[model samples]
Target: MEKHSTLAQPDTLASAHRTFATEIAALQALDARLDDSFEQAVAMMLACQGRVVVTGIGKSGHIAKKIAATLASTGTPAFFMHGAEAIHGDLGMLTRQDIVLALSYSGAAHELLTVLSVVRRLGARLIALTGHAQSELARNADLHLDAHVAQEACPLNLAPTASTTAALVLGDALAVACLEARGFSREDFARSHPGGALGRRLLTRVRDVMRQGEALPIVHLDTPVADALVEMSTKGMGMTIVIDDNKQPAGIFTDGDLRRLIARHGDIRPLTVATGMTPGPKTIAPDALAVEAATVMDAGRLNQMLVVDDTGLLLGALHMHDLLAAKVI
Candidate 1:
């Protein structure tokens, strides 16, 4: 349990809210400044045949890592390189075809500049995100984005706050611009992320894992009730497809149907498969994505789905457990 302190508030509390609003306002202003340089940065990345190498120092390094992740997820291959490590042995990660995106609030990070000469000699183009256009980093960069801010969120006006926000917004702007110009599709995005919820929604198709052939627990509509139960138990899918003499699905019989029949009629051996079966069970298309199948299954228990073509001929059946095991959910 927390000991609630009943302390009187100071006048500075109101000023703190004002500070947050002010920083947010700075971000809005920076959003409006997203222009050609943002497009140029995207173009530079699109033209590169090699990976994008991102480098920064201090708090800017954290922002740089996030920007790199956004780029990688959006179809641009990118990775962050520590500024100091580049002086050690990580500079070998850079190729001449790659582009360097450097971040420094003051447009000058001592460690980032350590390899500036080598990067230039290797003919790699530089795109810098910084506040000072005249600072060393900006002057040396091939393209510079102006992420200037009038004040910091800190009361002392020294800590990086509005500046960091501006840089983050600018990085997002660049990545999205590139994402659009490259015609990055949802399928492509899913290909890069086969682990995320969005990826599961886009990539997993039904045919990829649906149970087909003899694996489907099925029986003729006129098959004995005793035989149908045996088939369902053998397949372990909790249901069986009811097909007619023409080999077309007539209906379905599930554990629920059996329970209801036992409750209503109290049958011992008089009923047959057609007597208690549910005709025209819910079905799904083979081309449907696993995500869509999940939705159908979620609507109810949907133990199994009958896959069919346009003409409605039975193709196969799929189980909800199959989808779960495949990690399609």
Candidate 2:
């Protein structure tokens, strides 16, 4: 039993190595398969006036969904339709202006054949991604992409393994190629993925989310500590900015400073903000990304920050909660 247990570990490791090796070889084969056909596919998608509808069945269906999402999020407008559902009225989603990209490893899923015929009759172009170029799905399509692999990673060679990986990588290749051909920018990607963290990092500017104007807790340097506390309380930012006569930041007093003041003196109400303010506080510009502001606050162990202009004048305020609300954190 102990000998068998010891051998099992090496057996599992060998299986993993074999799986990786097979998939890598399959991808290499796929890379070599890329030629003018790949370029033609990309050009067709680039010139598409409507969405690219991706459809497949079973495991291929999952990959189809992901490819559709990748295309949509990267500037190519696309959505997934189930191959099985196409005959059940989901075919209404296809139009003459649209292009259908169908995935079927066998090149002949009965469900896909029926859907492909209907899509063709609807005047939509078809791009077939299949392992068999001689198969019906590939033969009826306007474009055929051979996503064939030599063998499965499965030890039995019965499961869809390396073939699926090759199909997925090919889908990614098509999406990225189309993305580059269209000259899609990061901002364009952010627009499509507005609910994600990448969108927040790319699109959310400090000034767009900062509290400014009357919301600023600005007090003169000569303001008493008690009055500064009132301004901070009214603004609800846990801090107050002390401005010089030229409307520039002279110093800043925060809840931390108040705590130190209370610990050092029994009566801090009589002292001016100048006596307790921290001089030359860190500031950020309005045009900076909110994620950048979050980075500054985190590096300094700060909970709040002040926004400023080029001449050292205070413009607005930023709190950690603001970054949180903006999803920039």
- Leading candidate by lDDT: 2
Q: What pairs collide in candidate 1?
A: none
lDDT of 2 by residue, 82-190 (tens): 9989878899889999999999999999989998888878888999999999999999999999999999999899889999899999999999999988899988988
Give the alpha carbon lDDT tens digit for every residue of 1-329 in model 1: 89988997677978889788878988888777778887777888998898888888788988888999999999889999988888799888898888889999898788777767678989887888889989898899888888988888887889888888888888887788889988999999989989887787788888887887878888997787788999999988888999988888889999988888788788736777798999988788888998888888889768788887788788888888888887877
Q: Top model by TM-score, which number?
A: 1
Evaluate all candidate structures by whole-model CA lDDT and list the values in order. 0.85, 0.91
Rate residue 113 of model 2 by lDDT.
95
What TM-scores do the predictions have?
0.85, 0.84
Per candidate, the number of residue pairs that clash is 0, 0
Off by over 4 Å in 1: 1-15, 32-35, 213-215, 245-248, 259-270, 296-303, 309-315, 320-329
Alpha-carbon RMSD of each model: 3.8, 4.0
